[model samples]
Target: MVCGPDVSTHTIAFNTSFCHLRDTSAEADSKLSTLIHEVTHFDDTFGSFDSIYYLRESRKAVGTERSKVKTNADSLAGYVVWGEVFYAS
Candidate 1:
């Protein structure tokens, strides 16, 4: 799964793997920030066998699913907010 420029609004699953901007050059800071954001979701869903099994067995847990989405959204929002603050200061 290749994430687009606006991955913040994208909904991605745990099983889905992505390699976005395969050719385009991205800044190190930008890439690291993106990776940090994406990895949080990956860790939450695939951190343990129980988590993996839960997703597989349920075909998607409602609460877990919602929580993951919220977490990612909040993280991105927070990143932007703090990044602005840091630059302004």
Candidate 2:
């Protein structure tokens, strides 16, 4: 589910499968993060919380140079497509 462009509310389910893509560990981890990020949005009880806030804060703590990071660092195109699927549902 893509929540908003204003926030990182996009998500995919854990049970959902992906195909035609190479199954590698990094890809798996990236997908998992995308899932967790999106699932966080689906819970009404926790939906009000901002996931991106923590993510950006954490990145800052790690000294990641903001100048080098893409604005859509967490957005995977496949995940975005999956989000569209959720939107249609």
Candidate 3:
């Protein structure tokens, strides 16, 4: 999903895939997977969550992927894309 963010409220306008995932049955595996991916975006945009921290927690694979993405640290989209690559659902 490509999230459109509103800096005013720190909200993301979910793209089609995200809306589909959210509207689906909560117990569905795909929904859970989407939740994991989207939550990382949400938290990175609106909360104190840090991608590097979680990447470290996910161990070497995630950490290695994180290293490959060039992020600005202040760019939400960069972080989101990085997470999608390193910590995909």
Candidate 4:
């Protein structure tokens, strides 16, 4: 997936595999929210090597999915929140 900068235009283009996983059966608002979620990734890695390095290392463990718990849309939205909460406990 290619996400645009954090400006007004939150444009994103998903590859065929991603499109298949993120089926169009979902509501438009939900899809838009998913796009916003992806944009957050761009926001995190905008110009930070540490963030990029973290992503690279994480991918090795989680592969492309980035989560060992759940690979659903919820993971995309809540991974960071859940990780922080889980670690705080």
TM-score of 4: 0.31
lDDT of 3 by residue, 1-89 (tens): 64544445656565676556543322232444344434444444443233432233333334454443333222223234343443443
Clashes of each: 0, 1, 0, 0
RMSD of 1: 13.5
Tell me the spans in candidate 4 whose CA falls farther than 4 Å from its real position. Answer: 3-6, 20-37, 41-50, 53-56, 59-81, 85-89
All candidates' TM-scores? 0.24, 0.29, 0.29, 0.31
Candidate 3: misplaced stretches above 4 Å?
A: 22-60, 66-89
- Candidate 3, run of 10 with poorest lDDT: 69-78
Query: Using TM-score as the measure, which candidate wins?
Result: 4
Q: List the residue pairs that clash in candidate 4.
A: none
Which stretches in model 1 have alpha-carbon errors above 4 Å? 1-29, 43-70, 73-89
* Model 1 pairs in collision: none
Q: Candidate 3 versus the native: TM-score?
A: 0.29
Top candidate when judged by lDDT against the true structure: 3
Q: Write the per-residue lDDT of candidate 1 for residues 1-89, one digit (tens) a residue.
A: 32422334445443233344222112222333444444444444422112222112222333345444233432332234344321121
